[model samples]
Target: MTTALVPPLAACAPVGVFDSGVGGLSVLLEIRCQLPAERLIYVADSGHAPYGDKPPAYVQARAEHILAQLRRAGCKAVVVACNTVTGLSIQALRERHPDWPIVAIEPAVKPAVALTRSGIVGVLATRNTVASPGLARLIAAHAAGVRVLPQACPGWVERVERGELDGPETEAAVAQQVRPLLAVGADVLVLGCTHYPFLRPVIERVAGPSVIVLDPAPAVARELARRLAQAGLAAPGPAPGDVAFWTSGDLAQTQRVIALLWGQAVQPQRLPDDPA
Candidate 1:
């Protein structure tokens, strides 16, 4: 008989969240709103940011390393908050840690395909995610008879990382990729990358009122709640939970951007290149 990969932990154990960068904060906000009693520990692997352009092997390696870090931190479960990681490495992650209670996010293509009045859905994501086999299979499985356009927004993730959400440069970068999808009659847009949600206001303004934009963070949070409940891992009290953060990138810069995106000042701890 197979043994459980991780023995069940106390309900009060912190839930770990990680991403290539601060992009995961988008999902963290939703989880905080949904599970206020649960403590959270977030790690930003920003030294290797924009996993969208990396090879699957490289992305998988980084994911495994960070997950090990989270497990060592005594987390009850983990949330893979980066779509690139989710699209390319989720299957392997689960296989490696069966029964570890992992919750992963992916593009909301299924919902977008269902909701589109024009029968066309556009996805904005990183290059790797746009080309991932997982995403292709997702589209095939759920988007039958629908026109699904996957658009890779090259520099969009960097802009969000730098906290440039609404400047002229940011607007132009957004328009360059959005206008063509709109021209092709895509009435629904999916924010396939977590960082893209921080740029949602600009995208919505560019797409105008008729277009619908979807972000999967809320759905991810709900699924996390379900998984925790099923595992008997949900936090037990009503008090507001605390959060801690660590990053492999420049601490000052990450701190600044985290403050901007998270809507409060937070000092993120440093994640060592080689943790002991």
Candidate 2:
């Protein structure tokens, strides 16, 4: 159960953003940076964290639940900050809501292919995203003449949710995933999951400075700004905008971690459970 608040069209409505867990904070940061005047509401579905391993139907149902909440709140637009959700449901959702602008995050395979001096790139993501048909097509389209390795960092998302970013356990977790890619001569690593960006320092340490790490969050934010402008939904403000946070997990815990990850204090509201 994750939700967002949307104010009236004439009022200060916030853009909606949601992810399986706190991972989407990486995307939120970019959105805030690029669209400083626009308010944003972020949903962290931490009660059911790691949608990566869930079946397609289950994840879709959960996503639809969140989207429904946002739509009810009067969201002018939404950002699907979860790559797994993006790969699985973007088209279906677009068909369902033809008018609402939706922006999705995807693996930066094309750029990784272009940037790799070794002609080899690595993508670290959740299991579902790596196995997705959408990701497969992304590979088919852009990975030509380059080696693309997809590594599922099984516990990475949970680590970020728990705020375990750079200890020995975190180090071991990062090293375990990155070493294989490095050994395979992957010169550029595409952070296929939003959560992976927080582990960038450890990942850089493990992969060494020579390996370039790319996060797609900023691009998604820019795309959002473009789409908002196109739809004439961009918020009008010279004053700094406000942000709201909600989570399905423990309210206090969610607030603490969000404050940490968001680089400022945050007070998270409990996401009300959807009707059965």
TM-score of each: 0.96, 0.95
Best prediction by lDDT: 1
Compared with the true structure, the alpha-carbon lDDT of candidate 1 equals 0.91
Query: For model 2, how does the per-residue alpha-carbon lDDT over 189-220 read when each residue is reduced to its tens digit?
Result: 99999988999999999999899999999899
The weakest ten consecutive residues by lDDT in model 2 span 1-10
lDDT, candidate 1, residue 135?
91
Residue 53 lDDT in candidate 2: 94
Candidate 1 local lDDT, residue 70: 82
Clashes per candidate (backbone, < 3 Å): 0, 0
Model 1 error, position 5 (Å): 8.2
lDDT tens digits, residues 87-196, model 1?
Answer: 99999999998868899999999999889999999999999999998899899999999999999999998998899999888999999999999999999999999999
Q: Candidate 2 regions off by >4 Å?
A: 1-12
